[model samples]
Target: MSHPVVILGTGLAGFTLAREFRKLDKETPLVLVSRDHGGFYSKPMLSNALAGNKTPASLVMKDSDKMSAELGAATIHKGRTVAGIDTAARVIELDGGERIAYRDLVFAVGADPIRLPIEGDAADTVLSVNDLDDYGRFSERLDGVTSVAVLGAGLIGCEFANDLLSRGISPTVIDLAPRVLPRLLPDAASERLRSKLAEAGASFRFNVSVSRVDRAGAGLKLTLSDGSVLDAGLVLSAVGLRPRTGLAAEAGVRVNRGIVTDRLLSASAPHTHALGDCAEVDGHTLPYVMPIMQQARALAATLAGNATPVVYPPMPVIVKTPACPTVVCPPALDASGAWTVELTDDGCDARFHSGDGQLLGFALLGAATKQRQALVSQVPGLLV
Candidate 1:
């Protein structure tokens, strides 16, 4: 009997690759292993679900059984943890000593939320919504909560702040950076989004970091580096995410910022591959949905004996802050360019240009977002 194609996660990347691969090759036996319940849901919806009147259970589109049948998987190992991988033997050992052989292996384990070290007794009470279970806990804690202190004014932080406003909860967003989305937007565009969110009942503390969190009454008190204190019903940390590379690294797979995979999404080990937030494909670690879609399609074809390479077009990220309509396609980190911003009455359009005047990237807010398609076409592909 032929060994099954085994996938080590049930997140978007893992399930997506399975669906894409099944479309091309149905006879191949497939097995999916997950650390959670193995439900199908859009992860990006977790942030704005509250405003959409969506509950944790409602967010899940399909359960493990439904997914198993839909994908025609031989077995769906829900709530199972992989102890280790024997790459040489093409087998994965589960925590309970059960082992499963695989014709090919994939790691789509995603990433973990970065937790900050804060001094105080209540520091452990801080919450981060990284998955469905985490969102359920956060939702349960929101009862009777009037305000929240959000750490990090990055993409997730800003979106949550805007979503919280819809539930009549005021959010005080604190970030070490001078402006919100400092990495994604230029100064003018960042200011535009800041002002819009501020107008929608969101507060901001720039250039300051949270030093401590202490229990204050039924809520929490956060002390900032600038010696300021903020009191709120809850504290949320949305600083950033780090790839889950330990499993792959321990298995002798090359690991850098993420599991190092070639352009073909193949790991150092034979018949082992990785993608999504857990993979640094060709030196690019993009934890976004679009890249994962591209990776899934390309990898699916490759697994189907096509040997296709993933091609990435300019994918602009649409910020989920209803308070402000914004889109951004940031330039490469190593790209040498300068931003030219035009601030309008209702919005701002900022573009990053190379020395030769080629459009490298752009940020569009409010009315300026209407030009998203036009501007996106001008920007070069991230990976071609």
Candidate 2:
């Protein structure tokens, strides 16, 4: 019997690649393995799910059985963890010592939330929502909670803060950065978003980090680096995410910040590939939806005997905070540019321009977001 093409995840990356591959070659046997329940859901929605009144169960669009029928997968191994990979033999060893041979192997393991070290006995009580299971736990903890302490001011942190406010719960957002989304938006645009969220009952504590978390009656008390204490019903950590690369590294596949892959999404090992948050494709580790979609399409074609290289267009990220509509397309990390911002009564149009007068990137807030399509056309593709 011929070995089946095996995917080791059920997240957006793995399922998307399977769907795209099936479109080109439906006859090939396909199999998927997921550590969780193998359900299909929009992970990005988790940050803003409260405002939409969505529960963890409601967020799942399809279960493993339904997905198996739709994708025509030979098997969908739900709640099974891959213990290790045997690259030389092209086989994966499950947690219980079960081995499965594969014609080709793909890693879409995604990323893990970064946990910060804090002093105090209640430090371990901080919550983070990285997947559906995490969201479920967070949702259950929200019962009778009127206030939450969010330990980040980045995209996910800000989105959750806004979501909390929409549900009439106050959120105190703490961050080490001076302003929100410091890495993604200009100072002016960041201030605009902060002001809007503040108006919606969101509190900000910038230039400070959470030093400790202690129990305070029925809630939690957080001590900041600035020697200030804040009390809240819950503490949430949204610091950031780190790509999961331990499995690839153990299997002797080249690993960097993520699982290193070439433009064709091929790992260093034969017949092995990776994509999505777990992959660093040609030195780029983009954890956004657009890049993953592009990678899935290209990798699917390559796996289907077409050998296509992935190309990326100018992709803009839309911030989910309804308090202030925002869109940002940050400039390249190594690009030399200065932001020129035009502040308006309701929003701001901030553009990063090169020294030679070229449009590099932009952050559009509120009404200025209407220029997204026009500006996107001007920005060059990330990879050609």
Candidate 3:
């Protein structure tokens, strides 16, 4: 018998692809490998879990065994990382001296938190919420903590700050940029969100970067660029995520920003494909659930022997900060355009229009967020 269709990683990307494949072909040999507990859960809910009065265990939807049984696929929990891949032989070498053969392979390795190099014991004390396990650890440390210093003012950082506030914990957000959600929101919309968050009892440290984190007795002390220090009982790093492509790259797959793939989701190597956060499809890698779901369906058909090109419509990322209420469909990474702002007393809406007055993207906050679906329908397909 031929080797099974193997997928690496059990996150949203891997499980969604597995479910999609089973939808078309019920009996195809399928295998899923993951480093974590291999639970079914919405990763976005991690930040909001505490605010919803839920524990880490309560957040998980299903365990590895249940997920495998439901999807009719073999599950390998806590598999060793792929050391390398022999594309010519269709085999993957595990770090544990194990080899897995695959008739078709899908790389959904996902991403990891991007750690910043800094000095002092406080660096070791800083935590990140990237996965369920990480959230569990962070939640345990939240007990009896009064203040938190969150690094980065991006979407995740803002969401965490909001979550902390709802749990009666104060958070001071520090970002090198002048405004929050710099990549997603225009200046006017960002300002509106900043004001709303401020009213909600969140502090900001803009135009300042952390130089080092020193353990100051009972708390962590953050040294900023201006020779000032901020102390917090806990530190959360939400800077960014780095895609897991080292294995694919070592396997001789083309990697640029992420694992390179065509519209059909096939990598440079034969019978090997990549998707989700690990895939750079047509020069775009979306780390959101919307894009992962879109890619899963298209890749499933192609992997099941029916060739289909993945088509992505305009998908707006809804920031889960109920305090400020923001939604955004950021323009393409290299889009060249100027943003025009229309502000209201309780809200702001900014549109990213090209030089030709084409509506490319938009950011909506507060009452303006009601126009998300309407504005999204007017935008064109990204990364054609």
Instruction: Estimate, for each residue in 75-180, the C-alpha lDDT of model 2 and write its tens digit.
Output: 8898999898998898999989989999999999999999998998799899999999999999899999999999999999999999999889999999999999
Where does candidate 3 stray beyond 4 Å? none
Residue pairs with backbone atoms closer than 3 Å in model 3 (clashes):
none
True-structure RMSD, every candidate: 0.9, 0.9, 1.4
Candidate 1 local lDDT, 195-263, one digit each (tens): 999999999999999999999889898999999999999999999999999999999999999999998
Query: TM-score for all predictions?
Result: 0.99, 0.99, 0.96
List where candidate 1 sits over 4 angstroms from the true fold. Answer: none
Cα lDDT for residue 189, candidate 1: 88
Which lDDT value does model 1 have at 78?
87
TM-score for candidate 2:
0.99
Model 2 stretches with alpha carbons more than 4 Å out: none
